[model samples]
Structure formats: C-alpha cells, structure tokens
Target: MDPMHRMEQLVTELNQHNYQYYTMDQPQISDKEYDLLYDELVTLEQESGMVLPDSPTQRVGGELLKGFTPHRHLSSLWSLDKAQNIEQLRNWNTRVLKLVNDYNTKNPDNPLPEPGYVIELKFDGLTLNLTYTNGELVQASTRGNGTVGEGILAQVRTIKSVPLKIPYTGGTIEVQGEGIMNLSVLNRYNETAAEPLKNARNAAAGALRNLNPKTTAERRLNAYFYNVGYSDDIQFANHQEMMDFLRENRFKVNPSITYFREFDDVMEQLAAIQESRGQLDYLIDGAVIKITDLRTREALGYTDKFPRWAVAYKFEAEETTTVLNSVVWNVGRTGKVTPLARVEPVELAGVTVQNCTLNNVGDIERKNLKFALGTRVFIRRSNDVIPEILGKVTEESDGEEIVFPEQCPACGFPLEQRGAHLFCNNKLACKPQTVARISHFASRDAMDIETFSEKTAIQLYDELNVREPADLYTLQFDDLVKLERFGEKKANNLIAALEQSKDRDLASFLYSLGIPNTGKSTTRMLADHYRDLHAIMNATAEELVELPDVGGIVAESIVTFFADPFTQAAIEKMLNLGVKAQAPEAPAAVVEDSFFSGKTVVLTGTLHQLTREEATQRLEALGAKVSGSVSKKTDLVIAGEKAGSKLTKAHDLGIPTIEDEDELVRLLNQQG
Candidate 1:
C-alpha cells in the first residue's frame, strides 16, 4: 500500500473515533485498537516526511510559540447582559416584546412572526472564536475586547474534540464556543500534578493561553460550538436551523440547547437548569436566553455592549447560614495573632465548609462577629473560593462573646496590642513562632533548603535546642544522625542543603528573616536600591520612604526591625558562621522615559514568557516600583494566565491592567 494513502486512511479512521468518543459520548473502537491505528499514522508520517495538515497526529502539541498575534474577529462577539432573578428576566422579556411589536407596527405589510426563545448553558470557561476557511480550521483566538482577539491556533488544535476539517467547504466561517476542562479530567490531572489547579475555569483558560501547545494538549481540553458568529454562504431563519447546519458540518454542538415559543416556558427551563447544574460534568455560571427567531433578533438589534434580544440568567452566588461554634487564635511566623472561626460543617460550592477566617479582632468587632458564637452567621463563597462570614444572621446576638486573648496561645507570653492586631514580643521564646520562622526560612522562595519542613523544625526545636535561624549553622552531622528518623543519608543531605543555603542572594536572605509586613517584592526592592546589606541595615526611615511605593508604615517597620538589638545580634552570629548573603550584580541605569517609569506596578499570576524575578528586575530597571498586592495606589497591573483575586481587585479598583502577554513582552523589550 502507498504510504501517503495509508496515512490518510488512518487519519480519517482516528478522527472518526475521536468524534465518537468525545462528542457523541460513544466509542466505536477499543483504546488498544485506536492506539494501533494512531501508531501506524505516526510512523508513516515520520518515514515519508509528508504529514498532512488535517492529520490526527497534528493534534499532538507542537513547539512553543514566542507570543500571541492579534486576530481581528470577522464579527463582534458581544457581551450578554445579566438577569439576577426572575423579576429581572421578566423585565427583559417585556423589553423584547415591546421591540418586536414596534418592529411589526413599522412594517405592517410584512408582519414579523411571534418571538420565541432559545436557552443554552452559559459555560464557565474561556470563550473561543474559531475561524474556518474552505472547511479547514484556519485560525483560533480568544474573545479579547470583542472586535479583536489574541490568536491561539496552535493551542486550539490540541483539543481533539474540535474537528480539523469539516464537510462544508464554504468561503469562511467563524464558530463561537467555550473551551472547558471537564471536572472528571481535572480531578484526574490534579491527582498527579505537582501544583494542582484549584478551579476548572482557570485551568482551562490558562491551558489554552499557554505559550507551549504541549501544555494545552496535556490538559485534554474540550469545546462545544454554540453560535455561527460569521459565515459568507450561510443564512438561517432561527437558531435551531443554525445549530442543525453546525451539526451537519461536523462541529461539536452541545445537546443542551433548547427552543421554546413561550416566555413562561423559558423561565421554567431556567429553573430546571439551575436545579440540575450540579449533575453536569462541566461548570455553568448561568443560562442564556435568546430570541429563537432570526428576524426578531435582527429587529431587536444590539445595545452598545450587549444584544437587546438576549440576556443571561445568572445563578446566585453560593451562600448559606451556619452556626459559629467557636473562635481560636493562632500565632504565625511574624508573631502576630489571628482569629480562626470554627463553624458547623455545611456544604457550599460542592465543598464542606467548617473553617473561616475572622482576619483579626478588629474584623470581629466590625462584623459584630465577636458575639456570633453559637449563632447562625451568613457565609458566602465568593468566586468559588474560601467561605467568609459576612455577618451574623440577626443584628442583636444573644450568644457568647469571643474573648480577646491577653496571652499568646502558643507560649503563654503576655501579648501586646499593636493597632488592630496583637503580637507576642517574646519572638525567640514562642514555640509556634520559632518553628514557623525556621520553616519559612527554609522555604522554596527563601533559602530553598530541600526537605526541611515544619515537622523537622518542631523535632529540632524539641531535641536540639535550635531556637533561631542562626542556630541552624551550628548543627553537627553527628548530632543529626543520632536523632530519630534521621538516617546517615538524610542527615548528610540536610547538612549539605544547609551549607548550600549560605550562598543565597541578599533578597532571599532578607525574606528569610521574616520582617513584619514585608513581602518578597519589598525585599527585592530594598536589595536592588541599597545593594549592600550593611547599608540597608543602617538606613533611616526617612530615606526608605523616598523610594517608590514605600509608605510611612513600611519605612518605620524596616527601620524598627533593624534597630532591634536581638536582630542585630542574630545577623552578627550568622555572618560570623560564614553565611554570606551575596548581593546581586550592579543594576542597569534607570530608564526615566519608559512607560513604566515612576509607576507603581503589580505583577500577578504565572507568566510563561518571563519569571516573576525577571519581570520585577525589568520593571525596576525601567523606574517602576513593583508591588506585592493591588491597591488604589497601583498605577498598572500586568496580569498573565490564570490571574485570580489580585486581578479582580485591580478591576474593582478601576486600575488599568495589561492582560495581553504579547503587549507586555513588547513593553518589556522597549529601550529607554
């Protein structure tokens, strides 16, 4: 048999198998049989070096891309207005009725038919705009600002459910759909992942936008086409007709789309969808209600940002009332005490919620949660994250009051009030504080001492009298081997790790010190500005405040931290023990004319093109002060794939954001 012909045959057979399994939820061949055919295709393509573009082998991810290119959408993908409740939905229906009646009154001779509605699940995933030219999938992009999007064709090709070739050889067409990670697939992937993805929506979006197509393939994403956004040779009287056309062309159309002639029937269907939402394998935040009649939709037309003929019926955010059983205070590495509330175990967002954060004693008073014990409190899981106590169900609570601790819970030391929080001054004597500090010092972001955990710290503290970070360098190998569970090999490895940590950079060493209210970004800034460790230690609060993004509080914290006699003594001992906190090389001259100059910037999420350190370095060199969190003071935010709370906060604060990775790269590469 001819190699090319054989390859073609295998490709067709494999594609059919994929469609049957992924789209139809049925398998025509066993896994072993499919693998045999796939292997043959791979071998033929490799030997002949004449791989077809639509080959099933092409679905295997290709090389890493430099950055995304801008793709102008054929037709705009408009945002949908949301209806929170049935009343809002009814109001929308009334508006639709008025529009249809007005259009008929204007054209009395050719009266429009009665409006019907089509309800489809609004999937909680990344929106995809797929462009097909002559029945071959030519381009795929994200719905960026509706009119234009970032091209992600290579990553989109990895989704096996999406057909590479369709039966219709029309001039051009754009299909709109969602790229989702199935809940089952996500669970399976997370079981083996080093850092498990927390949310399915974020996982799918991050994978599709990833620079490496191989990562997209590994995620095993799925897509369901719903709308034919653009086409040159296609016209339909209704959404059902358009859907039928999509199915005929072998696009994976979702089966959940339903049509109804009455508005009341649409309302009932929304209730049913919300009820059965938990049973679905994928996530849906809402159900979309659109007029089924094409003429009615055309006559109603669009608003500035949304279609007047369609609205999304959003499900309420997950919230419930649960009894607050008790509140407990816990000490952290910084010796600050925080309140943790224990509530009756209740289900929220498909997870058991029993623990919630009270933030501090100040928050308890503000929310009236100080007297919330033994009473029901309203808890909400915002954005599918950790549940928080909004407030007590009733304003007047007869329950017991949560007493503020006068002594440190971990060490029985008398606690001192510092503004809204209480702190233990006996830093070295406090057991929990000492253990946590040691664990943090050896953390990956700090000194990066491998295999050193909090459990190890407790064991050392109990047996070896190790109380501080400087005490680590004084440990002997013989002493470690004698401890329980410390074999000769393990002891040797720990010693080697500790020895290697001595050469960590100044930024890391500063972070390992666990300075109050200071994070990695602040440490890096200080290290870059001062250059010398001694210079930073001797710097004044006024001088520190002159740097960008450094407020009076942070300046005072730094000055006071260095002024401590204990801290100075610890530093001296560590230095005497040959712990060389090496400074970074001299930085480039600050660029005053760049866009980032004089701006306070925040970097969030995982950036594929540049490491967080690299981004911070570049920003600082361009005269930008990189911050750890989003605030009103933030001038710009550079968000990458899977950005979460910080990104949301930035938007909520109305701060400008740069979400396009390609644009970020361009800005980063610009010269002064």
Candidate 2:
C-alpha cells in the first residue's frame, strides 16, 4: 500500500478506537492491539517524512514553546451566577421567570414558551475554549477574564477525546468545555510518580498552563465539549439541538445532560445528583442549571459578570489551597505519634480549616512534602472529615523541612518507628493517650454514658488515675463526689450512667475497646458475623480477612489488639464488674408482601407526626428503597408539609404520591 494511503487508513482507524474507548466508554480493541497499530503509523510517518494533520499520533505532543500567545475569543465566555443553597436557586428561578414574563408581555406575537431548564454537571476543572475554522481545530485557550486567554492549542490537541477535525466545514465556531484529569487517572499516575500531583483540578490547570506540551500529554488528560459559544454558519433552537450538533461533529459531549420542563424538577435532580456525587469518575463541585429555550436565554441577557439565564448550584467545596504554617506531633489513643499541620486559616466545605492531618512520615515523603513547611499546599476536607494536607504546590520544595519528633511530646518516651508511623510504647504512662482512650470508650457511639465530656475524662485521669476503660466500671460514688465540680447529684448521675452502659450491645463494646484500624462499621460487621465477643477476640488475621471491606492491615490490627495481655485482662475485669457485652438478635427478614415491597420511595419535607428518619425506617422495614430525589423510577412519594421540588417532580413524572398526613400514617400502619 502507498504510505500516504496507509497513513490515512491508520489515522481513521486509530481515531475511531480512541473515540470508542475514551469518549464512548467502550473499547473494541485491546491496549496491545492499539499500540501495535499506533507504532506502525509512527514508523510510516517517520519513513515517509509526512504526517497527517488529523493523525492520532499528533497527540504525542511536540516541541516546547517559549511562551503562550494571547488569543481573543470570538465570543466572550460569560460566567454563570452561583447558588450556594436551594433558596438561592429558587430566588434565581423566580428572577428568570419574571424576566421571561416581562419579555412575553412586551412582544405578544413571538413570545418565548414557558421557561424550561437543562442540567449539566459543573465540572471542577480548568475551563477550555477551542476554536475551529473550516472543520479544522485552529486554536484552544483557557477561559481567561471571559474575553482574552493564553493560547494552548498544542496542549489541547494532546487530549485524545478532543476532535482534531470536525465534519462541519461551513464556517468558524468556538466550543467551550472543561479540561479535566480523571480521578482514576490521577491515582494511577500517583502510584508510580515520585512526586504526586495534589488534585485533579490542579493537575489539569497546571498541565494546560505549562509551556511544555509534553508535560500536558504525559498527564493523559481528557475533555468534554458542552457549548458552541460562537458559530457563524449554525444556530441552535435549544440546548438539546446544540448538544446534538456537537455529538454529530465527533465532539466528546458528556452523557449526563438532562432536560426538564419545570424549574422545580431541575432542583430535585440537582439534589439527587449531589447525593450520588461519589459515583462519578471525575470531580464535580456543583451542577449547572440553564434555560433550555434560546429565545428565553437571549431575552434574559447577561449581567456585568454572569448570565442571568443560568446559575451554578455550588455544592460544599471539598478542596482548597492554603499555606502550611507549622507541624505538631500528637499522640493518638493507640500511642501512635502523628503529624498535624497548622495551616493558614482558610474556608473549606463551610468550615474554617486551620489544622490538617499529614497521615505519617511515609505519606509526607511520598507526597514530596518532607520540606513543605511555610509553603502553599492543597488541603482537602470531605464528608465533614478533618482536613488533610495533600502535597506542596511544586515538586521541588524551597520550604523548611518538617522535622519528625525523636521523642513523645507528652510522656517524653523515646519514639519507635513502626511502618511509616512513630509510636510511644508507654501506653499506660502517656497521659494524652490514656485520657483519649477513656473518653472514646464513654463517647455517644460507644458506651453512651450520658453527661460525660473530655473535661470529665481529664479530671478523672488527673485526680483518680483512671487509666483504662476497665477502671470506669470500678469507679465509686465517693471517689467521683470528691472531684472538683462534682456535686452529690452529679456524682450519683455519673454512677447511674456507668451502670446503664454495662448493657450496651457487643458492637458498641468492641468499638469502645479502641482496637487499632477498626471503625464503627467494621465493629458492627464483626458483631453481626460472630454474635459472640469471644469468637471475634480469638479469630486469626487469616479468618478475619474473609469479611466484607476487611483488608490485611485491618485484620492484623484486630488480631494484634486482642493478643495483648493488657487488653485481655481489661476485658476480663470489665466482664467481672457487671459489663454484659450482649450481642443483638439477628435482624428479621424484610417483608416481601407489604405495600412498599420492592418499591423505590422518596420522602420529602417535614412530617409533623413522624420525623423523616422515622418515616425512612418504616419505609425500609416494608422493603422499600429510600431515595433522595423523585424520578420516573420512583414508585411512590410520601410528601409532608412544605414538600417542594421533590413532591412537584414526583407529580410531574406521574408517580404516585401520598400528600395527606392521614394517608401516610394509614399506609405505614398497614405495612406494620
């Protein structure tokens, strides 16, 4: 075959496979197979001294440029207004409705239809603007200052999902989308990486903004096209039509786009998406809600900075950058010494994060943060967890070194390094460790000893030498009454609470033991599986690893915790002091013939008679799958007072609803 002809055929075939694998999530060929063809094409291009402009091999990246050139966007990329809460979203909707109504009253003949909405995921990545002229990709840049941006055509071309040449050849057009580094890709990269990238957002943004195109290609980034900001030969009637056009031209459009006729339904879907945010492969900080009709959007027009027709409903931010001020080593209940970084006060996920966890010395080294003090670092807080310092801003650090402690801060014991962590083996002597263990044992999730506080633990430890959880069961009323702020009533109440905690279930008792590497879920699973405390204590690491979500580390931790002589003596002492440690009865089988059996049910708003939690439990008892939002798949909706978007959506979708309190009560009673 002629080299040119074969090259064309190879480019077409390889590009098709790339589209199928990356954009469509379906791979028709294996990686080895794809590589053989790619290598052949590379050889042919080199031999022939000719390369096609649209060749898949172009994504390999070219020479490093000195600097980026300024590229003025054909049409300004406007920012969307943000809504932090549902009320803010509702207010934006009200304003959009008023604008449409006002326009309709002015122009009666060609008035816009009732305003509908299109929902898209607000991707947490760098915004990219690509311009194509005569069907060929000519330029790509960031969404800088809305109008002008730094040109990054070479960097954008390296993204295999981006189309090199489009079928539309009538005129020039500019498409807008997000350039993202998928979470899975980031993980894989970090596994072999010497200095790991902090987050996906920063990885994508930094790669694109880099002067070296090879660095961008090495990240193996991806793009998802969403809008045609400027088009000379085409016009879209609505968002759906524009999306269809993008799809037809081989653009990588995200499949999660949905159209809704009612604004309330949009809100419901946004809430639903937010609840399942973890399921996505990429990071999405929010959802974008836009007017579906082009006419309505045009009528609403733009503000000084944002478009009035669209708003981004921002979810709680999970990640942000902050400066690390200092590092403090603290002893945990297990006598493990961990580094806690005190960062510059920054707002993250609605909380002021001043302190972040560094995990251990191994993590600090792996993240290239051994000398990251007094430098900017990316901090992350998710699901209300304590913030974690991911890494430094740059691979090479100019900051001061974070010195690992040679001795325990509290007990002044020589620290021992054990698997990336420092430990103070003086468990009985360390005051902080002992105090933490006692407090954790009496916590609400553990023994549920009411009116107990950390302050109480401190006082007991300082005055009465309450060293271990077993000591709590041995405490006398006279001892407590002699402590500061412990009146007769308070002392009596403490004794009564301690006595009541003796009957706690085996799961709670196990959690209160402060077993290493075990959480509530793991303890609960162990309790359910064994049904006896002795069985769990005697189980080997090999046997424990068979349980769900249990790994080698957790299994070994559990076995080691039980093997200790001190732990065995503590358990025996507690048992002798009237601690029952009873296991719960096996759960009853789910009712298969109830009204809510095998159904998807949604509960919305405030139930005057029963709390939402109580209603959810009742529904689940009848074998219903409780969901956060309403959709066509929803079998029934229990709408209470002030039920807003979810109830409205259920009604719109023609799903059955129980709005009356009496009807809801009757159904729940019937199930029982």
Candidate with best lDDT: 2
Once fitted onto the true fold, the runs of candidate 1 whose alpha carbons sit more than 4 angstroms away are 1-316, 383-385, 590-601, 622-637, 646-672
| Model 2 quality (TM-score) | 0.69
Weakest 10 consecutive residues, lDDT, candidate 2?
645-654
- What TM value does model 1 have? 0.55
Error of 2 at 163 (Å): 7.4
Clashing pairs in 1: none
RMSD of each: 23.2, 7.7
Best by TM-score: 2
| Ten contiguous residues with the weakest lDDT in model 1 | 190-199
List model 1 lDDT by residue over 537-601, tens digit each. Answer: 99999899998768999999999999999999999899899888878789879999998999999
Residue 173, model 1: lDDT of 95
